[model samples]
Target: MSDPAPRIVRRETHSPRSTAAVIVALCLAVVIAWVATEGVLSLLGLPALLLSPRGMLTSVAGAPDASAASVIAVAVAAGLVGVVLLAIALLPGRRARRPLHAEHAIVVADDTMLASALARTAARTAAVSADAVSVSLGRRTATVRIVPVSGTRVDRDAVRGAVTEEFTRAAPTRPARVSVLVSPAGKVGS
Candidate 1:
């Protein structure tokens, strides 16, 4: 009997590559179109709407005669822009995403949902109201903020344990360190 084919799992997080590339492509297209329009107008012996290609070349050729400070500033600006684009192209852009491992398939959960779940788990474990707990999940850490009710003490260690357990149950590929923060000021009446 033939063995089953291996399944390929796609674990890519959100990246700005497509958006950046599209924006750069559109900008280049606009410049090329403008130059083509100017060339065609010159050929037809019509009045140029803007500077002609020859005029642009002449200005560029005479740019060295301009003030040294202005030329240096322009060159530095262009170099900085080039470096930024190169960094964007080479660096891997990663976003915060929660993925739950399942037997049959992986379920992707929204960041807000993950945060809410962690908050709820911590609140329930700490014997507090839902509104008393808040969670913020980052790339490598999940911070659980708790505002205790007046005259009540919240166990930070307990809350941290519960939140950590719940997060571990989710089984994300990239695990985050769970941290519980108890507010110094307690809320009134709740």
Candidate 2:
């Protein structure tokens, strides 16, 4: 029998670059639209919305002579904005997601779903209700919070072992460190 071809998946994470770019484009468009409107109004001998294009150009041309400090400040602020936009475009954005190891298929798991599964497994192993267990899955850590039922003893080791085993079996590309937290007080009727 021939082996199945492995599936190729592009592990692309969500990024804020597109949103930022759109915001920037919209802002620029608004500014351009305002300028064009003002210019047309001024040419047509109509009252300016805020300032006529001729007056705006004159003020901009004379801005440097108004105050050297203000000019420098504006230049610095513009430069900082440019740098920030550049960094946003160049830096990689990450999400709370990881790829699971599979033989011939690609599988990505969200952190929330992964946490739920781990919590369910831990809860089942501890013989407690699902609500008794809470899991917080982070980029490099998975914290399990367990609240035992009243008058029932919960073994932290067993819960930890079960969660660890489940996590290992799932085999995420980036494995998270597991930490179990057992509440000192047990909940009643849980």
Candidate 3:
């Protein structure tokens, strides 16, 4: 009987939302520390001039009489902060590339690594210099652009097949559709 295939384990990673949560927590901590310090100092009969809670509230209460320009500036600053926070809350964090299932352990490759590998494979298959190839790896697609030698014609299908083969060997968890584009303008001296 054939041996059973080993299980593949994926690597654990933190999401961007977690990082943002940590940042928010730290900011809250700072605010809490300031308020606590101010309250303690006030109780000790040595209230901070402008940092105390009462002082801060009074400052806000008095802001209505501030110059128009200053008010506008403050409003703009607050708006910017709100926009940033909203973005952090709404934006999707970067997801690590899906892991490839293997016989033993799961394998993962960065998008850049996949692009480089595809580019190199395409270049070799097309018999062109590596610099003449450009590759873009997306979540569901891999695009390879190749510039053939000035006097030679490159077979697009051949390049595509080569890149696809290489991609299969890499064995990404999610298979990407391969696309090969041969540039109209060929490179000279390469």
Candidate 4:
């Protein structure tokens, strides 16, 4: 056996400093922008709010002489309406984000659909078959994984199209990512 060179681990070699700097700068920029915006808005609103309290109301008649009972009644009514609307908005959003009982999420999706779709698309493009397909559901997102069935060819474009077509019809919302795992051919167990 021949001697092999020692493997050098360079974690940052695969990534660039420019990309890291850009991402950091982007996050810092967003934070600074939000802070500046909030500061400016608060400063501008303070004068109108404190210097001229009467200006806060549309009508001068309702400012000083409004009875406490009327104010309480209005506050209660407003709170009730707000709570109802908030519940209506939040419940549906939460429900939509989660599968209706985890077991029922992928009723129609199966190993056959994914395998056949990838195989058919591969055959049409003269590409190699994908070994297996796995589907995952997340918060308002679904992901489909395609692993190469053989070493012949992995047509990423065709795979993406096939995966999108299948998910578009079945999933409730758009998928977040589709990853194609390239491995040695005939490794179906993997």
Candidate 5:
């Protein structure tokens, strides 16, 4: 008898943060539209409750000059805004792990989930409690730290091998180098 085909799962690429950006952009667009409409109405001598660009400039011209404190405050606010925009532009937007490229479609899993699986594998292999294992996943590395039970010695090499084997089986898109560190202190409750 022939074996059946493997099932394929789709990966989601949407970022939750992108929704906040879209809503902010829509709000800004609405405010810009209102300002433009008001400006046009003022130009045509229609009744416009909102101030137009020209009216705003004329008001500023007739107003008293800004004090030193006010000028410094405005400069500080502008600097803060610039910093925020720069961070938004430079920071990595996606939180999803690298996608596993397949023949038909790509598959992706959360880094935390993959780390948890590797931790479980290591714990089982080391004969230690799951809580004794800690896994940290980086872009190109997976660090597994293990704490053995009190008065019990653990084979670091065996735990490392098991962790690396589990990571390989998981098959993350980008292969990560596995590093295992055995803590000096062990938990009393195992």
Candidate 6:
């Protein structure tokens, strides 16, 4: 029998600069401390090379410090770290956002004349705007009201139509209740 194909998976990638910088910062701290374990003087020598201007830092004229070997190694590591951090900084990261949703509910009654009522109710329920309130239907027996933006208007008849339409649209086996409420013009008095 043949082996099954390998599945491909998607992976997210992010800029390494922030991560690289953090890693380098940690490594640099360790390197400094490690040099001191050997001797304080070596620690002083390595920093000058690591931080100095370009040409002047090549290698000390003539013979190098016995500790120069470790200094060179540390410099290379720091350079590599710096590169990684910069690359990470340039990379993009992912952000998530959610879409807006309107409220919904179920309005219930006998299915006997639901189909007709739903069709007649289409226009009244179809218009939706920021000013317009959202409407829907599900099981039955429900009443809810909410603010429809000021310029936005809610038609009682249309609300009824929307619920009816949604209910009708459901398959015969999937009938649902309906109600479309437009909350008070401003606020519902306590």
Candidate 3 per-residue lDDT over residues 1-190, each given as its tens digit: 6433222222231135777778888999988888888888888989595587788888899899989999999999989988998988886554555455466654655668768878989888888889999998776788998888788898889888888888877764457788888888877787
Off by over 4 Å in 1: 1-12
Tens digit of lDDT per residue, candidate 2, span 137-185?
8767889998998888888888888898888778645566889998988
Q: Which has the higher lDDT value, candidate number 3 or candidate number 4?
A: 3
Best by TM-score: 1
| Cα-based lDDT at residue 40, candidate 3 | 87
Cα displacement (Å) at residue 113, model 6? 25
- How many backbone overlaps does candidate 1 show? 0
Please identify model 4 stretches exceeding 4 Å from their true place. Answer: 1-131, 172-177, 184-190
| lDDT scores of the candidates, listed in order | 0.83, 0.83, 0.77, 0.48, 0.76, 0.45
RMSD of 4: 18.0
Local lDDT at 76 for model 4: 96
Model 5 residue pairs with clashes: none
TM-score of each: 0.87, 0.76, 0.71, 0.29, 0.65, 0.25
Instruction: Name the candidate, 2 or 6, with the larger lDDT value.
Output: 2
lDDT of 1 by residue, 128-172 (tens): 899999899887799999888877888889888888888888855
Sorted by TM-score (best first), the order is 1, 2, 3, 5, 4, 6
* RMSD list, candidates in order: 3.1, 4.4, 5.0, 18.0, 6.2, 17.3
How well is each residue in 1-190 modelled by candidate 6, as lDDT tens digits? 6432211100111222455568778988998765444454444554443334322344544336638787788789979977876656775542121111123522233333443345334434534432333333223432324355455556766666556445545434343455555655643322
- Candidate 4: residue 117 Cα off by (Å): 8.8
lDDT of 4 by residue, 1-190 (tens): 6422111111211222454457657988987776566556666775332324344343456645788888789889979977875664455332122111123232323334544554454434434433354555444344545454544555666666665565454543435455444445544433
* Residue pairs with backbone atoms closer than 3 Å in model 4 (clashes): 130-149, 131-148, 131-149
Candidate 6 vs. true structure, TM-score: 0.25
lDDT of 5 at 112: 86
Separately for all candidates shown, the number of backbone clashes (residues 3 or more apart, or on different chains) is 0, 0, 0, 3, 0, 14
